[model samples]
Target: MTILFRLGTAREAFDVSMTRVRGGTGTTGPPPPGRRPERRGHLRRIRADRVLLLVAAPALAYFLFFHYGALFGNVLAFQDYVPFLGVSGSQWVGLAHFERMVTDPLFWNAVKNTLLIAALQLVFFFPAPLALALLLNSIVGDTVRRFVQSVVYLPHFLSWVIVVALFQQVLGGAGVVNGWLSTLGLGGISVIGNPDAYGPLVIAQLIWKECGWATIIFLAALSQVDEQQYEAAALDGAGYWRRLWHVTLPAIRPVIVLLLVLRLGEFLSIGFEQFFLQRPSVGPETGEVLETFVYYTGFANGDFGYAAAVGLFKGVIGVVLIYAANKVAHRLGEQGVYKA
Candidate 1:
């Protein structure tokens, strides 16, 4: 009560002093605008940081030339896009392709597969990295931890083609597992090419390849948690799980929510390379995703306009999902990927 009273009294004194100063200066409103000098100062700072700006030039150019530059090509979505005619020359038939997309059964199938894979990933793959990070954090030996991290992180550097082939060699119908089972007079189980097992298989592959790399962020967050808090919790007779639940998780909750929001933004983009490679084996019915659907429709079927419409639609949904997820994160008192 005393602390609150003192703070209130100090605030009142400051406000009164400010009002007197303003009245004496004959200023009845806010102070004069400082924006012009602020802008000059900002420009001067940028000029001083010219070398640093030079270093960022390549990345700035890459985004400008690729991402923002490509945005103009979304104009193809509303046009009957033709390679020979080009974007400006193409006939503009607004929303026709969008209507076609709504009526297209194949497009709906792709949507279904994309959502299923995304849900599977959210449920199974999302937490795998956090769990692995916790397990790795519990390890006492530096040598063992470094070795395990190196081994796990190596897969993330490998291309999707190599990863898929590695999985096939180990888990496919005629692979090591089936071969061993056959030798033991046990029946072999089909896995790689099976549509029914596609969801679980893809989830497994994603976990194996990306889980370790994903742990990097969580590990960094864990490193920032104060050791004193853990010690205090332990002194209070809290067990490992109890301490983790109370202290560790709260410290890292912001990082987790940030990653979750970012992940939700790209929820439907479950990767084209992996699904495209496996699509032939599992058949399009089970493996088609938005990216691959866009690829096949535009390149294979020569429906460039329709494909662009689908791509634009996907991009819009991604933006909306990110915005909604960020809002939810804000409501839950997390900063998420962006500020409200």
Candidate 2:
């Protein structure tokens, strides 16, 4: 009887300990109260948001099918790709296309032109939006501010073709400016077909068309700035310029840094249509960029493999630039396009 009682006590103790650990029966029971409801809540939320998920399905599918799927074609960079033979039967030339690209004078010229144009844009075009945003944000009247925004943003909606045509009408050799110059007994200056002025002209066109649209982002950032900060600066006897330097700029600095980092990533991809349409006017020496170079090489010269190599090289450079820029942003204590 004593032995049986001891064994029963030991068994009971074991069962109690096991139940405590399991929060119920020894083997299992329902999950702990907190976890089961939390899990159920998560599943419930997912079910509730099924409609939104359904709405997003098409866009997700498009990106998966088109953008991500197209990444597989990068293999053409290694192969001497032929359309007739397709990817499977193409002869692999390894790095031969890349080797040729490195030694090609035309390729180097395109790089030079691309860098020069990109530099011009970074220096001149990049700051225009910020300046305009500041000017717009200073407006005391909402009506005037909104009207100005609409006028500036209207250009962004215009197609590149329409925008280019409008610029030609205003600034081309035989256009409005030249017409006025001729009436004043002055020589009509070359702008449209002038290779020397092409860089500046491209920058001008970019600013006119896109500067206002870019300003929208800056303005949005500025809107988020605390009005109290500006008021405090004013109470401290800080003037407009001083307040702008100290308060306004600091508030939007993060946005500026983020945009700058993103711009660096896309530094080489200065639009195909813009350069292509203008290339004939300025000639390849002035206007050939990586985009046009790729197009001409692949479609015009039918050198698909070499073009793919150039494109792949460009993509690698972009990745490096974005990574470096993001690192710099993190070092400066700013969140860039992504966290470090």
Candidate 3:
């Protein structure tokens, strides 16, 4: 009887210890007051965010139906696609379209122009926003900075047609710049339709339209930088340029690198509307890009299969570029578009 009582006491002690460890009575109980169980907490969060999810539903549906659904059309790249025959009746040509694309001189020309424009954009246009952001950040007064920002950002909202017209009015042979030059007895310079100047003109237009918008991102990044770092650098006898080089640039280097990687991923897509509108002025030799090339090949010539093949190739290249860039980002110890 004594041994049985001892064993019963030990069993009771063990149950009490377990109850304490579990922060409950016996084996289980309701969670402590003001605290929710894990599953309940997750459900509560989902309920709280339902409004936001509802608001985003339309956009999500549009992408699902339009963007992702259109991916199925890529099979046309491998077939001799005929509108009358439909996808189901289309003759499968295997790699014929791809083989033709590989040997096409026009496609190579488009590629060359695309690469040239992309390089120019990387060298000149990419740095404009950063420089502008730095200038805006240096302003001491909030009112002045905001006013300047508003003025610069206005162009971004203008349509590409309006922007192109504005450029023509400002820089065309008979426009303001030429009229001023003619009054000064100087020869009027041709810029709008000049083949040699087409690349620079497009880059200039892009800078005017988008540079300010891009600056907003850099400015936001700059705002997150602690002012104390700049003050400390100044105290160490570092001048304006030195502080910028050591502190400001380093603070935003990650954003710059991230943008660069993203930029490279879309290197071949140098805007369709801009190039299509300007192509007539400079001719196809100078103005043709992959976007325009695809449009002309597909819609204009009704060679859908060839165009689809070219588009598929471009997409594959973009994917490769993104993967390579993300890998480089990981190597540099930065979080890229996605986690390593």
Candidate 4:
């Protein structure tokens, strides 16, 4: 009892000395004078706000510079753009270029092709990622699922040239299939250089190249779904399909809507490189889209002003589409693409 008392006394003295040294008069007293409540609160708020601003600045600058800066350059569409004269010096054509665009048969053809390809993509390509994600989610083994994911994602890193070349090598005249067919004394398919088959081929290429990567977003959303909810549903006698329909889908629905809206914004942009490279072989009837139209008009036909107008037209349509898509998302009980 005496030893315990001495130890306790020593501890108290040490604590008292430390407290005095640190300017705390009592054990439960406030912090030192240098770190007052008002000043600390100010510093904390300042730091937090600074951190938030730092995080937000890069994305804001990126949009301002690339998106809005490019938007400013759209003025050339209204002017007779000249190489010698700057955008400021260029003559204002007002609605002349827009008039030309509407009247041009080539422009109309490009618009038709773009819409057809985009629709095909929406119908065929859009659902593939969700299907893939669902299939992946069903896989029980991590090793097998990861292996499949990696293999599938490999094609996304491949360039447009490489993807087209891969298609050519497999389906071209002297390709593997044709070579096998020749050995069996069979007829050759003329799909390689034909414009008629361009739509299907491009869609197929898009699937091969982008589907796996696209599944990544859906998979991420799927990963966040509550396992307990699935368990509860299963306990309630919900089967796999029921759980998926009721639980899994509802969880990932927001992401699906978000991706759909973004895709709608890119509706007018069905890959320039792919079309440009294939156009030479298949001709413009099948390969022509807004991007390619702009390229040919400005560079091939040497009509920069008309090409800019076509581009401007596409841009406006994309903005309208995105706006509409966002509105639809809001109406369907989902958060839209943007928020104030």
Candidate 5:
């Protein structure tokens, strides 16, 4: 009671002093016309914004639950996780699994495959979407353009199983290529099951599946670019390629860099389902990427602890890579995805 009284007294005194300084009545009339509506306006804004907050609440809750909750699972990396015993009851191994992973030849092989695939993606898959976006941007007809876009984007919606099956139908042994070759008296190309071709195959598949979908973002960014810039470039005697080089590329460079940084961050995630499905036939050497290695470690070999450790390591590496990429972006005078 005494504390409340003292606080109230202090507030009252402060209010009196402020009113005296401002030449306004302490009880408040219209708050000098400027300040009165602000408080009411703030309350009105809160009321209006309440619905938006309520609408977004579910997504916020999902992010908190799934993202933040799964983050805690990283603890298993440092522990000998006994599934039956649960996390709290598990033995603390303190990077034993990490040590084992570094020593394991299979783990090293998986790492090598992942890095090689990532490099391939960076080299080939990265530029394809940008090129597609540029090509799409050149189209003057809306109906024809949308038709092309719909056709291009359709592959992205297809399931990995459907995609892989389609690939097999076209390229697998005894499929269309083999049948065509048999008719022509020529040998078929063994792409599907060939270890030598596996890396290229995955990279090509990733490009085909994701290239069009990835172009959506680039196209969006391209759409925001000023048409007048192109007009000016043309007036200045620039060709289509030159205008694109000087104007269009500059406009979308930030977005490209941002996407590239994000891709760099996910370099290890060559993909789970694709590699997992293909690895069985292609054998471990060509197909055992990090994600599949994790799945096999956990489910196949029943080493949940070790698998979790591997995953945790990958996640940490991802975070570090993203951070490093962002730093590099800043150094290059580029606006990175995540600001430091």
Candidate 6:
């Protein structure tokens, strides 16, 4: 009986192999007994996965309250909002704030600065993580690669305040490098708070802080690439660059395009904490962006209505940009943030 069972198994395996060789779908096994149990068990599995749902509850609630909840206050944009009078009591001025935004010179300057910083980040900071991931993936030594990855990823967990402080300590006028330059009788260079160099400095800070963290996705995508593809390419006389261009890049192109689309959606939101902390030092001329503009207009200057208008404007633009980017991604034959 055991010999008979073994013969039957071998015959089944051979049949499946022959089916695949004939370009069949390779699912030559017996059909499933029923689908209702699986359908019914989904709810039971959900009950079992309650712990995961509970873990995600806080984050879900946070976004619900802070993001969607705050959206109601956008009505303040069209009102001459007074803290004491509140949104309900405030007189509705209609498109006054938006009209002011269009004519405000400082607002335009802030927009220009924001665009400049965003462009710099897209051009320089965006590709740094991808390059790092590719280089790290090339390292064959698991121990060395893991050690290097850990060291690079550590900076991402640091708070923006801590990151800014570290930069100031190392690059401030009286800081370590400048002190050394002074000792060497070469004039100390100004970087931390210098307006002319602010763009590069901020981009450098972003790269240092987030580049490794960003690689987590690319590395995941790389790991999913079929090793057999690389082997086949090598057998076909493809060199390193050719194999990378043909195999590795094509495998990860979906992930790259998805990330690029998301990045473009938030092109106007450079950041708040790092720039905010350095704003006073660099002065508004160089450091002011949309976030800082909103903060100063709302909190510092008591122009809540104007600030709300600008914030709402940014949100609208963000939604539009995300939709447009996703459309472009679809046109290019890539599944973007969502399916069509």
Off by over 4 Å in 1: 1-61, 326-340
Q: Please list the C-alpha lDDT of all candidates, in the order they appear.
A: 0.83, 0.82, 0.82, 0.79, 0.80, 0.83
Per-residue lDDT of 297 in model 1 = 95
TM-score of each: 0.80, 0.80, 0.80, 0.75, 0.77, 0.78
lDDT of 4 at 26: 51
- Looking at model 3, residue 170 earns an lDDT score of 94
lDDT of 2: 0.82
Q: What is the lDDT of residue 325 in candidate 2?
A: 58
Q: Score candidate 1 by lDDT.
A: 0.83
Write model 3 residue lDDT over 1-340, tens digit each, in one string: 1112323433344455445455667346565676554556767877867999899999999999998877888999999999999889999999999899888999999999999998998899889999999999999999999899999989888888999999999999779999999999999999998999999999999999989877877898899888999999999999999999999998888768766755675576667788988988898999889988999999999999999999999989977886675555444432322232
Candidate 3 wrong stretches, greater than 4 Å: 1-61, 327-340
Q: Per-residue alpha-carbon lDDT of model 4 for 99-213, expressed as tens digits? A: 9877888888988998999899989998998999899878999999999999998998899999999999999998988988989999987677888888899999999998888
User: Model 2, stretches more than 4 Å misplaced?
Assistant: 1-60, 327-340
Worst 10 residues of 2 by lDDT: 1-10
Candidate 1 C-alpha lDDT tens digits along 21-117? 4566456667566534344576787986799999999999999999988998899999998999999899999899999988899999999999999
Could you tell me the lDDT of residue 46 within candidate 2? Answer: 80
> Cα RMSDs of all predictions?
10.5, 15.8, 15.1, 15.6, 12.6, 11.5
TM-score of 2: 0.80
Return whichever of 2 and 4 wins on TM-score: 2
Q: In order, how many clashes per candidate?
A: 0, 0, 0, 0, 0, 0
Model 4: lowest-lDDT 10 consecutive positions: 331-340
lDDT of 6: 0.83
lDDT of 4 at 216: 77
Candidate 4's error at 281, in angstroms?
A: 1.3
